[model samples]
Target: MSNTAAVRIDDTPAPAFSAAPMKIVVVGHVDHGKSTLVGRILNETGALPEGKVEYLREVCDKRGMPFEWAFVMDALQAERDQGITIDTAQIRFATQFRPYVIIDAPGHKEFLKNMITGAASAEAAVLVIDADEGVQEQSRRHGYLLHLLGLRQIAVAVNKMDLVNYDQTRFEVVKAEIVAYLNSIGVEPTYVIPVAARGGVNISENSAETAWYKGPSVLGALDLFEQARPATDLALRFPVQDVYKFDQRRIIAGRIESGRLKVGDTLVFAPTGKSARVASIESWGVQSLSAVSAGAGQSVGITLDEQIFIERGQVASLAEAAPAVSHTLKARLFWLGRNALKVGSRYKLKLATAEYAVEVIAIERVIDVEDLANHPGAEVGRNAVAEVVFRSRTPIAHDSFLDNPRLGRFVVVEDYDIVGGGVIAEAGGIHQAHKSANITEVAHKVDFETRALANGHRGGVVWLTGLSGAGKSTIAMEVERQLFLKGWQVMVLDGDNVRHGLCSDLGFSPEDRAENIRRVGEVAHLFAQAGMLVITAFISPYRADRDRVRTIHPDVFHEIHVAAELDECEKRDPKGLYKKARAGQIPEFTGISAPYEAPEAPELALVTTGKPADESVAELVRYLEANFSLTARNQTESWGF
Candidate 1:
């Protein structure tokens, strides 16, 4: 029992102090006395309040049934009649060394789902086996699950030794067999004790019936299990659970899974890459606390200095130490479905607060739960384990299980039920974070200045911007023809020509238009890098969209705005687009009923309403030659800020 006395309060309140708090799960085969062992622990530790056990015993007697220790956990009438544990039950208790929340996991085949849910939250486990029953199927299966669930701290309790006449040989034989199975799954028990939970022998103290055993008692071995690594020492990971908007402030709330978060700290939400600064740390009842920093499993609410569109399923991490971004991952999963998990089958992967559509790409190997041996298989059978690869339809922020368990685990849902679970072994895909990192660096195999000087002109993008039918395309084509005639390398990327091929799949929505402009900017940047002058003509209406294009080629991006009144452009409807737009045949037609955000600043603006196409082209050429050196030189000069 703990040094602190158990206080009985009318309305139960949390304990003042109880050492380190830990979650321990008890699992084994059905009828293996798992609940009996739990009941014995609660009784021996003095955790049960006065009259509680007597009350239960009286109830059992009134029902004309034998009062078993399992009755303490199997409180439901169905469980008592069925004589099986159907769900996980939790009880709070404490030993001399620490406080515990012991979860009793169900052992029936049909209730393995409940077992998994209970085991996943456990930090340590106890595997129970009946001495007379020896090793059962669930003995091996539950042991394997403890390994798969990443529970390294475990102990084995050989219960009902009194039923075997307290024979040492019988206990050793059962322990050896079970130990071999656990070893196969790469788990080593902290202690293996021979005990009779019903008889209350070898539980809190060594029993004379087991004089041959020299190990610590059950209570002693439990105290030896170490606590999990401290989350405050690891990288910060806070998964947003909800966004609450109270009055003028928006608060992001969640549990801090790892590390500490402080006010004024900059945070980046993963997958979306949105950034924010912590404005205040909020606690429910604390009025004077200015800062909040919590370790693993502590709930926190924070308001940001600047509001950004963020929601649940986005992991908040440090900007420099963000999680991996990918849609493809290799994982090791345990299949618990009644139906086999097959290749090409679609399922829902629930990780943290996110749910994604996933498909099994490959079943690398199926593990024999009984022997822990690998074998080739086309699918993962019911209650089987396998190393599989899955492909998500969209990218998710994650870390390898070995690196961060909080962000690495996921459960698979089939037909609206959780049927499988896994942990990421590796993050790999086309849009990997490593590949994205490489994009930020300037790749200079052939120097940019050298290529420009050899081409006799500085490579740059000539972005011609105006409404349709404003002579922008005509002037762009004429300039391209004139440049080619001057023995200069030039290319024209007309918006219509690009839409026919490069952007054939895009539509005319606002989102699609932004994407179209982004693609054009990328293509133009590549052409300029190759020491060629690229001219682009489009009705790029949004100022933010144009600014995004400018950042792509900041050194040489020139915006030539072609000015024409709406009346003039409508009168010169070259492609009859205005007529169709006015006829209501087009939706989101820029500058016609739809909004058009014109540029606030332009490098050059030309009045093309009454000007000839040749005159506009000449002015463009003069501007380009006066600002850029078109003659070949041995050295190149940097231009623009």
Candidate 2:
């Protein structure tokens, strides 16, 4: 192994001071000596109570079993009998540098759920591997789980060095294997040290048994880890728990999950678009103060300047940097339900203080934890990690996990039981439009109502979505022509035409397709506002993408599904693209390789299979006249053509 200068152990320490305790989770495979290592650390650091170790030795002696270091942490009777930890145990200890909370997580496969629960709150980790056995399957799984939980600071301890006779070559081999795997998953372990936990070699002091090894001991490696960033440094996320009315003041009560709040600060409640200013900070037991400021993790009550209808489940943040308001979001979740998690399954999502009814819209991919390979799967089995997309009927406020972990993580509840948990990878559905601080929106002189009256018709968007060869463009063009001949302003935004100019820079990737649809939707909305019928024909495959467009203007946006079977559309092959896709010339072609999620319920469904294009166009024209033509509704006589 490539060695660094030894971290000398100080025999005497200075007086300890107050500091936040850093949480660290110790994990490994079964029989890898994780608990033993934790026990040794506790004993060597003088963290154990005066008589705790003697008490444990007496209990073991009476039980007719030799005293083992693992017995120090395996406190339960079942754990002692089975020689395995079944539950997570947390113990606090203080070193000269700082106080630490060491969470001993179970290594048994059956207790992985409990391990996850324990590691979720940890900021750093210690992964234990057996020196004799090197790395095992469970070791890799635990390492991946640590990465999944977002624990970046890690230390790998090759325990039981005595079993391998303190072999330097063996330790180097194990270190190389684990280091390569961890690096593949974006984890650079802070240190990889070889130690014998049962013998207390390198637990706190250097031992002559492994004199060739020159690195910090496990405790020293831990003390070197930087503390996690304070929550107050992150964006503001105050979830309102309740509101109390005390005499004349209406006090909003909640805990600040991140950032800081003070008197006179303006707050905006999400999903409601309501704003209020903090009039006064209220405390129950304390005397009235001149100025009071609450930061992350503090619970406080405050009265607002204006009395707006505010309730629980609403998040408060600064107006300039608020959480995303969306009905759709992508998540990387680990499913723990008895039944498989499939698309279309309904569950309640608990995010921070808010609860929303969400349905799984898509299962992007199932990740194989052992090898880190992604495979397309229809459902996620128990303990499987998968990337999923969820949609709610109403908008929910949240942030990406990278932005604010407090507001970004959520749990999936079914029948009042938490079946899964995940982090929000991306927020979508309806994005809050933002402009530059110095820029302003110019108002139009001619409004939609005035333009509609002059044109004798109402303007709207007619979005046609379906398979590639479903004749959406053909029917859209004919409908536009018929409407124009009847003295109404109409235009067609065909997929190919838009790609030639407006969306020319984009490609056919899923993300690119969603962006293409978004740009077209915005343009269509602008046309509708200008009193002109805008017809868009595109193979917008994702349901969430279509829903985003409908959310732009539900009153005027009409979705027409040009229904056609995939086989029939492939046979038609109007543009000869299907042949190219089948021959491997094109990649991610919808209806062949990529997925195409048809609309569950559209405004209209026109079956164009075996039907003439002209007939479909005529039917579309009649539907528009009845729904959008204002003159047609009032006239008693028809105009002669």
Candidate 3:
């Protein structure tokens, strides 16, 4: 939002003209003439270079393509090589009403994630639906998403009218269908224009093809309307993307959301509760005399009046209405990860400029994003709209997506992968999401030293891997009770027991089993975060999957092999699941239909042939005490459990 590099998109400083350029993006389904519409606009307005259109035509002839409209977004080599609009692209055009900076986005399902980079910053959206195609899936979806993203002003350009014989009736049919869907999704397009972008009808100039319809042209509708920004003009909020400091002067770089900032004004930092005064505002080496007041669309760097500790994540806000900061968060999630979102999917939650480890606590309910009706018992999966509860490893200052988008939206990343993106509807919930690296009381702040005293030496996951009726849970619980008696702060996450509460509705598919282990791993990690030794007993049969669980907790996880042969485990038949599996009652019964992969490397292996729980508990205690200590708090109220 910096004007020094690019002129402001909308607002003008004086009455003569608006300095903020009118930037808009046109997005919809493929083959709907989005790029052609842009090309037509540029051609009619003379925005493109004299030879650019001819070059495109020549390129299309060489490639033997019929000059599809989507080719116009080939600003980068990667885009042309991929033969798809891999990212949101921008181009400029002018109408009698206003000049526009248009962003053309991809419509393919595979590239919807890429669409976000374009739509996230736009003031309004123009959905191009094919007049013949009516409201396609992406059309309805884009409309719904536009509503969700809080883009208020909308205008629909029903293109391809020429294909429908330029019939106003055909245009009306598509218009009604789209209007119905948009209204159902809580969006009312200000105007719907029937035009053929390729034929040059009703683009920048009026078209005579649709004489039956007396509506405005595409450019007419846009020119007639004015830009409407987010309401309330809330306090100035900007998320620091990066911090640059040299020669003892600090500069924080970010985009402004609303309101303004001036020099010598008091500012507060989020989640950290720190405050400082702005000494100066500088951008492009120009020092703003009024640094305390910076309007929206302005990106400025400010120097503190007093020397203060700052970080990339910390939010600078007005002294009033401090941003919420807490580890526990409850919000609606739109799961877009390659795998279904379930309990124990731990990843980094990137809120504002800060990223922290996060876990899915409870899936309140999964709803179909398209239908809006709640799916009473839906488990996590791709493209699901669920009201899920999650917690972050540390407190982050953020506002609700409904209230302030400047600091409300966030994306979750797993290592280098962007798995999920969500809005913070609310934060600082009933449970605390704080954690410590170690197990016992200690003098140090690092997790290693505190863990040295908590569990006795070092902490790790005791993964009990076996088939059903292998007595993993029974032994795990018994050992936990003995450790509790010996003054060990131990937590037991039983695989089946957890399902009865946290994961009651999940089924027993291969994917479901992996989700179960993942959830258990995350819960055990929380217990470890609380400075307690956690014992996890599940039939986590897959060695690679079990290894995946260990990676989640790192040094705090230990994979324990509960070696009970299939024949011996079936004889025990404690749960009768084995008998049912053999009788064809269950499809995914381990030791019958499903295969259980044993661990190649186990920190502790207990042969499950009637080994007394007491002996197993003693052996676990000795091993854990030899390596890790039970960690404890060094000071009162250290935010460590």
Candidate 4:
């Protein structure tokens, strides 16, 4: 973190004023007076222009209809005629505490998607309920949604109290039922007030009708609603949305999803492990500045001290608080798709600025929205919630929703439509979770030592990495042939050979390349554990990805960098890749358009630019012989093989 941006949230004092308006949403069951509550707030706060209410009354009289305060929020003619809100309508108003943007969401089952769009962005929520109708289906559904959206601060408005004779017993009965239901789903409302939106009781001020009630007014409760922890004070998490080149300088643009960033702060982009220092803060049509700190939802662009190849879908966070990197995640999903969320089905998951192909590997349990009952199911139906395990096609950078909502929540897109939304519950513990649940894992009866003794050699993998046309494949093949002749169990895993089948669906993007290397590493590890020496040849451009492979097979993995100049590799381009890359026919071609991060310290470094192929093979063989002996006599006796 930069010195200017570093500030502990606990040490900061609360501000008396806010530059940004508070965003809150009003939601509940249909015909529960949600729109009326919003309209009453607007009318009392003078948010509506003068004569607007009279104009609506005139229109209602001409049509021979009774005037309704809900008409103020139901702007669409269809909504007014049908007496239902079909979409979320945003109404801006000011309270005594601060300005607020109130979002009125639809309650119809057919329009749950619209409700999600509104609630997902709101910081707090106000759930409306009809005192006479009590708790309805939409009431329970919307309450669960508030929890899923990570909105902890909530207030309840029991409207239509006038219809129930403004009875204190009626209000308490409805409040108790709702409170119990909400508590079952882990939501506690800050305040539950009795109000008749049409009669204006307890909305702006206390009503004589509810003398038994002793809570703050609706407006007062809005002021009591605690503001969320400022993003400037949390850990820095800026997801890169785009990289722009304006004349000579490059600008990285994104909203500071959390925490603050200043000029000269060292930032690391995850899922790629690329780091850069902020050179200057950019603001359009404004005076230039050396440093800038943007809170949540504030978009800003900054130039880096060094131009690095980074694009959308990468999170830029402080190096000290780097995000989690994982290929699988456990999430609680709210399914709204037309089709059921079936296990093993694939969907595109979009979170913040990152997107990946994700699959539902396991459906843990489904919870009924109406009753909050957990039921076992293989698929989650529309308008249902479930806990599921999702495996991404590649690694993703994320945090738990409890830790950071901006980077934790994601939406599932099927056929280009957002069909589902979810919040990450856990990251990087798929295998560990499986083990903790008493699930038995199938194991191989033949141990590694016994297999190695039978093969007369130790199991291992020699990973060869370098730029394209660097003689990696040739050296690997030669080494494999020599080892086979020496009566050792040896095999060669070429990148192109495996791509023909195992990785046919993958491409050359940074994410795809990382997945490709991961798959290859897994295969090589399996071979090594089976008591066979595996040799892998690949460009493996990113050092972080190569490092991940080493972590996968710590004991058996050996990284050998086949050193060769870029010019030499280009000249020796056997597959015409360099020619294609120079002609702009291929993008992200390593050593040309894309980057190639060389290993800082490899097990063996062989210069293949001018040296003969035979000499390079001889050097590789010498190192392998010294490290991995063909004879396992000493280990055979120890293991009693």
Candidate number with greatest lDDT:
2
Candidate 3 residue-wise lDDT, 1-641, digit = tens = 12222222222221222345565667888778787777787787888888887888898799787775555666776766666566777887765445678888777767767776677767777889998887777786667666656676788999998889998888888999888888876678877888898888888656678777666667666655566544337756655666788689888777666556678766776544456788877777655443446766787788887765667777777666556665456665556678777775677888766777667766777755456566646367765556676655445567777667777777778668887666665644211122232556555355644553544533345667777776678778877777778677777888878989887867775545655666787777766775677788788755545765675555667777777778888898988888888889998677676567777778888776777656766776677665454343332222223
User: What lDDT does the true structure give each of the candidates?
Assistant: 0.81, 0.85, 0.69, 0.84
RMSD to native for every prediction?
13.3, 7.4, 11.7, 15.1
> TM-score of each candidate?
0.67, 0.73, 0.59, 0.69
For model 1 the TM-score comes to: 0.67
Local accuracy of candidate 2 as per-residue lDDT tens digits, 151-205: 7899999999999899999999999999998998788998899999999998876
True-structure RMSD for candidate 4: 15.1
In candidate 1, stretches whose alpha carbon ends up further than 4 angstroms from where it belongs are 1-18, 242-251, 274-276, 282-295, 301-309, 371-373, 426-641
In terms of lDDT, the poorest run of 10 residues in model 4 is 1-10
Weakest 10 consecutive residues of candidate 1 by summed lDDT: 429-438
The true-versus-predicted C-alpha distance at residue 572 of model 1, in Å, is: 40
Arranged by lDDT, best first: 2, 4, 1, 3
lDDT of 3 at 50: 80
Worst 10 residues of 3 by lDDT: 7-16
Encode model 1's per-residue lDDT on 278-297: one tens digit a residue.
99988777767756655667
